[model samples]
Target chain A: MNSTAVTGHEAATHESEPGFYGTSWQKLMMWWFIIGDAILFGSFLAAYGFSRISAVNWPDRTQMFSLNFITVMTFTLITSSATMATAVAASRRGDRKAAFNFTMATAVGGLAFLGMQAYEWYHLIHNGARMDTNPWGAPAFGAYFFAITGFHGSHVASGVLILLITAWNAKRGKSGPEGVELTGLYWHFVDLVWVFVFGCFYLI
Target chain B: MSDTHAAHVEASYRSYWIAWAILLVLTLVMISISTKAFLIGGILLKSVIIGAWFMHLKHERAILIWSVVAGILFAGFLFLVIHFDAGTSLL
Candidate 1:
């Protein structure tokens, strides 16, 4: 931890200290924001649950979706989460190379998950279950589907971008603790959201 | 500050890998169970475990964890109350 703002110690400092958003604090705030946003997504999912109950002919999830592919995707994602955590741990230990490799591995995992999701979306769309089709009775189903998962996908894409930037900075020896930790926070949040999504949309 | 201290820091990271392994197994278990039955309660439990251990939420301030819990509970309560009305069915 750096020292608090003081008189004599401040004079010799050549570099400006980064603000909270500049590194760890910014990442902490992002986590807080994601938590709140997650609640909103949860509400949407809860509403979907409510709608599922209300529908007279609620489609069978097992019939409509396949668990095998998602199973592979799930494994890929969870493994990615592991790699990302390893990256964070390595960064904290100043093993920059390990951190970079793990971060890249995590990004590849994210890409794989997204690719699987894209395939799932294609499968769903091909079956005449367009976002507006409302294969179930509730029209809100499609709305929530696109809105929540789309929002999450956007976050995943952004996380990938950050992972790239972090790796770049690491190679340059310019990456700082806050930056690495903040990226870790974002990666964890993405995985957390998927846990709930898998439960709500695919499983339950 | 010293080489020995840095080594200690590195050693602490070992538990992180263990935590990650536990989470991977839990995720597989949850997906399997999700197919057999709609276990909302179980999902909640698994989430708590992962969040606390893998996500390091356990090391976070009590207030932060409580805030998240309260938010989820409030949302749950509101949904329940709204759906309790007669002729209302939450599918």
Candidate 2:
């Protein structure tokens, strides 16, 4: 398929648009990027798993993680994903205000998640479990803790920034499917990656 | 091509919302089961669902699919090579 045929809403003709699977070209590119990212992060988690298998002892996530706060944070993020999808739908219907509200809600969800993550880290570090401490007696555990979660957190921050920009542009009536869809793609990827991260780190 | 394409896009929007809701619920369930070995499986499975539905990977072009598969395979090769040689090779 010719990607050049895909275009944002304002393109001259829908047939000339480069979108695939009903999405804009930029959204497709973002998915391609996510696939590559999955590989990068997947390798890290695989290494962690291998190391954990080889190690004698591992810490309990139930003991290590504050589940109550994390649950709330997770709820916020899940809600954000819902809001983002709503925004996408609204944008398609030409409801700019609703779309902007949902995007802003998604951003707020991202920020709330980050704030909770910060609090979790503060408590965890204060309790002496760190990459150096190895309080759980598995150095790989500590390494994975800092590496995966830290990297995911950085992505969340950047995704929030992108959402903010998208919201602003949408409000100004200058937003294109390229930007909104790309942000949606990234936001969805972030949520997808978190599923694995949460499973490997917090849950499993 | 035009008429069929429009129909397909319309169908996709319906599926998209359904998929999104399924994903959201599944994610929460996976997280709720935190600390279970199944959590990892749940996440992996849920990711595929979201990728296919929300990210529309299932609808992506062949080039996109091949490139990602090739890249992951190459990275896996690198990992295997490094791990196999880590014992005897000097850093």
Candidate 3:
């Protein structure tokens, strides 16, 4: 890692003067953001779990959540993470066009995931699910469900916009490789958080 | 200045594909474990895959990686402290 920011040419070298604990300042900041975000998501999940484990008669997941829809959404997000990872690798390899394309595909994946979420939400709302209400007698169920998934959906929305911007800059050759890489990190963190959310909310 | 990653991480599209495949398999395992005790295990496996491969945390600086570990611990701490306030199933 050189003191200079990574450019298209330097990205090919894959050599680094680890700026801050093996990454650039921007990259470090992204990780810090993720850490903070993780804490918040963690607390919400914990609250949901506590509500769940203590239930006398909880609505079973099969009845409350649409497994097929959520499973597809999970795949879409995971595929996006793969694309984001590929984009980072491409940028590191100095293939800006390939990197830009991969990132674009990642943004598409985010859009696809959001589309699925919207469809699911519309269907659930039609079935009488709301922030504070649900068909299930346990009103707390709807509250936590929407709270957790809604929060996650918001992150995915932000991620899509960030990816779009990163993709646009990569196309224009305006953003440095480090910038692309940091954005990629943020994208993956969103997916990472969703992993647990899926497990806690949908599976278990 | 020290690079946290091995100079030769062999970062490539091939690796990304491999990670994606692993994730899909883990998802399958998780969904199947849906109501089982291993559901939590499946979740942890998925997270490890994403953090190590997708986030490239495996090649990141020790401090960065440890920061993630610290974050997980902090989350665990949060749960432990908050569980008392949540309702109980004990009859």
Candidate 4:
């Protein structure tokens, strides 16, 4: 998985080398990084799951959350994942304009999602929900809620920055197809992670 | 880079839109499907579409796909292990 493996394609130098495996080394590394991230988030969610199930007085998340807004945020992320797909696809076809446009749309979607998260957090905090304290059934309720969601949100924030930078590179014609695809993979992973987080915190 | 690259570079735009619509519908259905089976089904559908198609894992090398599968399996194992001792004191 070293950078040296990609000598076949001229584009490999700037974007990534095609590795021992069929995929690019950088792309493979991104996949591995995401797998690690999945484990981290999975552990947190698992802990939260057990904690809530074991606790006698776990608060009802459905009632605690204003579902409409958070639902909007989730949809925004879903949209971003789709746009990211198109961006990578367009980049692969050498459609620079379309790739840049779709990538920008994805970044904007990420930003909108963050804005919604911030709004949700502000009201949740103002309403006396804290990682340390809440009138809810157990302190663990507030604790895991913020901890897990914040961890996921931070990923989204960074993902948005990544998309912005990637989009900028694409606009400048400096990004390779592999680079765009790798960025899309990261973005979609973020969206997929949110699915579980949403299920655990809201639907469950 | 090769003739078999298939969708390595371009994908069906319509499929992406269809996947997005499916996700939106599933989210709406989330409110009604709290049962364990439905929950698992929803997650599976969402995960497959996003991972297999949206993320283009379907065309990736076996090493990458298997590693990700291993990661998910391990995560599931974690859930199982924690479920057995879910409420044990964290501190």
For every candidate, what share of the true interface contacts is present? Answer: 0.36, 0.35, 0.72, 0.74
lDDT of each: 0.67, 0.69, 0.79, 0.81
The regions of model 3 sitting more than 4 angstroms off are A1-20, B1-11, B84-91
**Descending-TM-score candidate ranking:** 4, 3, 1, 2
Task: State the weakest 10-residue window (summed lDDT) of model 3 chain A.
Answer: A1-10
The digit string of per-residue lDDT tens for model 1 on A8-102 reads 12212233444533323444465667677777767876676677666666667686678878768777877777787777667667788987898
DockQ of 2: 0.27
**lDDT (tens digit, per residue) of candidate 4 on B42-67:** 88789888998898788778877888
TM-score of 1: 0.81
> Mind giving the per-residue lDDT tens digits that candidate 3 earns over A1-204?
321222223432353556758775656767887899899998998878787776766677788677988989999999999989888877666678988999999999999999998898888889898777677766788888788888999989988887887777777776666767878888888998889888877877
- TM-score of predicted chain A against the true chain A, for each candidate: 0.83, 0.88, 0.89, 0.91
lDDT string, candidate 4, A117-167, tens digits:
998999888889999778667888888988998998998998888788788
Q: Output the worst ten-in-a-row residue range by lDDT, candidate 1 chain A.
A: A2-11
- Show pairs that collide, candidate 1: A20-A26, A50-B91, A52-B91, A53-B90, A53-B91, A54-B91
Q: For residues A1-204, could you state the per-residue lDDT of candidate 2 as single tens digits?
A: 212212233322332366544445555555667777878887886677656555667777777887667767766776687678767666655678987998999999999999989988898888887885657566667678888899999999988888887888777766754556667778887887777677667666
Instruction: Provide the TM-score of chain B versus the true chain B for each model in turn.
Output: 0.56, 0.62, 0.73, 0.75
- The number of the candidate with the highest lDDT is 4
Clashes of each: 6, 9, 3, 0
Candidate 2, superposed: residue stretches over 4 Å from native: A1-25, B1-21, B28-37, B61-91
Docking class of 3: medium
